[model samples]
Target: MSDSENPVDIFRGFLQVLKSFQILIILTALTGLALLVTNGMIDGDWGRLSGGWANVKIFLSESLPLDWQVIEARSYPVCEQEIEFFCSTAYIGMLETIKIAFVATVFGFIGAILLSSLAARNLSPTWLSILVRIILSALRSLPSLIWAILFVIVVGLGPLAGVLAMTFYTIGYLGKLQYEAIEGMESAPLEASRATGLSHPEIFTNVVIPQTGNHLLSQMMFMFEYNVRHGTVIGIVGAGGIGYFINNYLKLFMYSRVFSLLIIIFVVVVIIDLLSMAIRSFVNDQGDVRRPSWFTVLLPAKNAVEIHHGSAGEEES
Candidate 1:
């Protein structure tokens, strides 16, 4: 009859809190099996998949006919001299890739602003948050490559389709991140700004934005970096840029060129990541200098380890 009479009682209570159900597990397994059967991504040739992992024999072997020798061929663009010569000509397409990514980022940033505002748990009521969450989730559910493919058919094959896809895709992604940033924000500056009789828009732009500025910039940079990497791949579906070149080489079975393209992509993505990291670090450090920590105003020491609320003005409640 004492609390220690039955440990099983506590175990049952824990199970009740979890809403433990065998039916959910069974449903998950069933759904997984159905997806495995239907999705071509799961139709992986396990034996060759292991072989492919080692980078061998990806395509079926074939012999070219003697008539192929009659056609002229361009030499591989290599060497410092060739790089200098062709970098301008050859990389015009890559510049187009950069442009595509740039346009996409701008549109994506705008869309993210709107969607994230609505998605903000603090700014939005329960129903609005739920609705926008579902919409953002739907935007994020599809692969951007697939979106590019669909758009290529609708808009014709070019960077426009890729840009559009990246924009739409990033809206969902950045919206989710930015909304979480808004949710996790401290309320002190916000309250102070509101108490001054600032409008809601003014409070958001000045107080909240300054508080989260560093994180927001870092997130935006990360989104741009992510788009660059994905932008490299989407061209395979005829969206535009180097991916299209890669697909062309792939069609011709020019594995050497494809390998070269892969190398280029690797270098570019690494450079992009490094640049983003450096910029984010520098910007964050600088931002901290510009904004005084609203939470640390009453700290006893310069490097205070803890925030203790000594008055009603400090703590929320």
Candidate 2:
């Protein structure tokens, strides 16, 4: 039979066309739903959307010439340093936010590592994995803002509250990422370790961690950056950070000052993104999207070399 006329070939082509048509239908339905939601949100007043540009123009006019005064020392504090920027509200708030994020990320990373090990099916029993996943889901269900408000009420308003809130959220978020990474690991080493009667702790530490080291590092860095951005939200609830100043400025209708603080935050977040990229480069020679789990790391040197060459040879075909 000719290639195109073969029953298998015709069936495969039909399936491919059906798949493309299904994708197009899904996209069309999603677009229609989005439009419906937008209409509902505007209450049929689409004209309001046209006025949005005017409102934006007015906001820009009021906020432009970004206030450099925010970086100057406050009147009450009595500046101790020769450089005034150190004592400024912007600096103090940003520094506090960074500190809270750092501490929370560290604590959360440790807690997530423990919880994820238990949550991963490869490492723990099915019942234990489900229980731990339920716990993580509970933590993640409430956002950092709600957690911050709760902590603020319990601990009083400060960076301490921010730290606690972010820590809990980070644990949930990072635990999900960690356990998934662990579960995605190749089963060869795990099976071998089990056959040799290695302890759970030994298998986890010696086999699982090394296999997913790059993924763990990348997830931790991402969580740290996530926590940093969330600091502003938590701080708005009196959890202490740059967002505290931002909230105050908003209340006082000082848009220029708020804009200035946002600029500072943008700069800080950009720096953090760059730093995260650099740190991930240590484990991931490839880009962020292609973090291959290095399971061969668990094999003996000779076996690892053979596997590497074998994979490379296969790829050439």
Candidate 3:
């Protein structure tokens, strides 16, 4: 029988096609569901969406000639530093946010590592893992914003509240990520360690940590960036950060100042992302193949991927 006509060959071809299109099919289904839900929420009044552009235009008209004043020293600040910008609200607020995020991320990473070791099924008994998982879940159940509100009430408004809120949320989030990474580690090292009669703590420290170190670092960096972004939000409720100034500008309808601050935040976020990528490259296997650069990151994905492959091919050749 011809290969094309063979039933087994036909079935194999069908399976290959299904496998190739599986992701596309899933995305299409998800998109359709999202559209349906959005339509219902809007009550089919698509016409109401037409005013969005008009409102945007109005906003831009007021926010145009982006305010540079935010970077200048405030009058009360009495610019004592060599640079006036150092005394600006933007610098102070953003610095506070970074401090809060940094403290929280560091503290949270330590806490998560401890809890995740216990939660990892490969490292701990099933009962212990389940219990640890429950504790992590309870911590994660409340969003960071809610945590910020609670802390604000407890601590009476400041960066302290922001720090505590972000730390708690980070612990829960990073704990789940850490345990999953631990679980996904190769079983050979773990089995060898256990066979050698190493204790759970020793096995975890020597084997699991080294094996999953790259992933854990990546997660910690991600959590830090996440906390930085959330720092802005928590500040709105007087948790202390750039969001405090943002809230003030918003209340005063100073859209221009708000827009400027947003641009600053956007710049900082981009810088953080680039730094994260560079740092990860140092430890990731792909670092030897191709290291990332600012220009590569700014380029479109298709072009960046093509450039990466081209470089890799050249290296091999």
Q: What would the TM-scores of all predictions be?
A: 0.64, 0.82, 0.87
Arranged by lDDT, best first: 3, 2, 1
Q: Is candidate 1 or candidate 3 better by TM-score?
A: 3
Highest TM-score: which candidate? Answer: 3
Clashing pairs in 2: none
* Tens digit per residue, CA lDDT, model 2, 95-203: 9999999999999999999999999998899999999999999998999999999999999989999999999999999999999999998999999999999998898
- Candidate 1's displacement at residue 302, Å, is 26
Deviation from truth (RMSD, Å), model 1: 11.2
Q: Give the true-structure RMSD of model 3.
A: 3.7
- Residue 200 displacement in candidate 1 (angstroms): 2.6
Tens digit per residue, CA lDDT, model 1, 1-317: 78756789888887886677767977998999987876656575556557675454433222222122112232444334433434432264456677788788889988887788778877767899899999999988888888898899889989999999999898888889988998899977777777789886786677767778767777887887778778778988889877777677678977665565566666776887787777767646655543335666656664433433233335555
Encode model 3's per-residue lDDT on 1-317: one tens digit a residue.
Answer: 88899999999999999999999999999999999999999998999889899999999999997998999999994789999999988999999999999999999999999999999998889999999999999889999899999999999899999999989999999999999999999999999999999998899888898888889888988898899899899999999999999999999999999999989988898889888888877667874654766777999999998887887788799
Highest-lDDT candidate:
3
- lDDT of each candidate versus the true structure: 0.73, 0.90, 0.92
